[model samples]
Target: MPETSRPAHPLSADEALRFTASRATETTFFFDFDGVLSPVTDDPDASQPVPSVLGVLEELASRVARVAIVSARPVSFLRSRFGSLEHVDLYGLYGLEVWHDGDVVTEPAALPWVPAMAELAERAKAELPQGVYVEYKRLSVALHYRTVPHLGGEVERWGHEQAERVGLRIQGGRMVVELKPPVDQDKGMVISDAVLGAGCAWYFGDDMSDIKAFDALRAREAVDPAFFGVAVAVANPETGAEVSSAADLTLDSPEDVARFLADALPVLAR
Candidate 1:
């Protein structure tokens, strides 16, 4: 990432963002939860959204065609923090589960793997190192090594081995590795489908998986010259440089994300 973040494309940040704001009601905004809305922490369960982000997102949702969080987390985990924002949709576990219009809808294909994932969770807890944290989402399992960064290589090896053993898919992040059903769904597919009719879109994220979402935006721009897309990255010690390098612009932190939205509200409302 550059010392001062700038647009990787021809259009400047102000120019592209302003263009999107000008078409607020025809635009959709997608965000990642862990490091984009909430600060990354050693304890995954303790992670919470920045105090002001939810309020700003609620206000932004009111102005835009749609506001959605497309994250690696489960819908239940996302809802615990964002349920108050009625208009904001939730696409959790990378779109394997969705919460929209007061109902939770999970992908039919992913349901069959629930028991396998549950079994994998227990196996992980028993087999993995003591410092590693095993987070079990019904459709997936995350082996977190943030607290014990030194165990990353061991955890990753174990995770991949388990994934292979169970015929599941693997996703690697900052200091965590996850095993999920091989359903062919990801942030890219989620954003590609979600931005179908929107004139403009923006995706904010802070991990390796988010690069696919950035690619989706670029692909949309290639086909539709009229469609404007912005990819914003939130900085973190892990995965920050890589994600930022792929983004249109980089914000310093989740607090910066909150402030960015707050500042954009006026332009969007206009």
Candidate 2:
């Protein structure tokens, strides 16, 4: 369920954007890359952000206190896609890594788990089904069954077994399961810390992992009603309904998100 009951009549996307823009200089915007900025793809490497959204984010970074990408992808991967925006920050591996000022900062606690993750990745490649895509991040591993949907259950089972054997944490997503260091860090923790001193914060996401981010926003509102937080979910065929139901508003696609942000520029300017 949503942290707050749905309003009798919810604010439209444009209305929500304008409301957040009202506190432009004191606001922060956090976005999830896959399925939000970029369409979720079978080949994760092929995913790319909507062209117009990059320029929009650059503009937003100048107006807002912070503009960031909080994603499951590693900082290196995110940098490959969005490294050019100097003002945009990247929090990858669900906050286990960050790209700031041309340098990659990884959570020190997770560094020791690199060897474990590497071994798990190789094991996954050798044991998982032929169609399963194994993505190996230094701090985590993802098993993607998007190409063979029917194998989702098997892949998930395998991932959990591996996690238990290695004492790693499991994060489930759209036809994918991931194993990461058991560190006490996630999107929720990242957002909770980032929103400090900001009058308004907006989080855009498209999966179950992002619910934690929305919950962080709600937790803030609970403590301080004056703090305005918006949870926007980008619609997708899978997990869209569940994620959107938890969000304050929903946009149909990444293109819609681009246009939504672009439209808010003038409002923030005023």
Error of 2 at 208 (Å): 0.3
Candidate 2, superposed: residue stretches over 4 Å from native: 1-10
Model 2 residue 67 distance off true place after TM-score fit, in angstroms: 0.3
Worst 10 residues of 2 by lDDT: 1-10
Local accuracy of candidate 2 as per-residue lDDT tens digits, 151-244: 9989989998988898999999998999999999999999999987888898999999999999998998889766878899999999999999
| TM-score, cand. 1 | 0.95
Q: What's the distance in Å from true for residue 172, model 2? A: 0.3
lDDT score, candidate 1, position 219: 95
TM-score of each model, in listed order: 0.95, 0.94
Task: Report clash pairs, candidate 1.
Answer: none
Candidate 1 lDDT, 1-270, residue by residue in tens: 111232348566677666776677788999999999998988999999999998999999998899999999999999999978989999999999999999999999999999999999999999998999999999999999988989999998998888888899999998999999989999999999988798889999999999999999999988987777899999998899999989888999999999999988887776
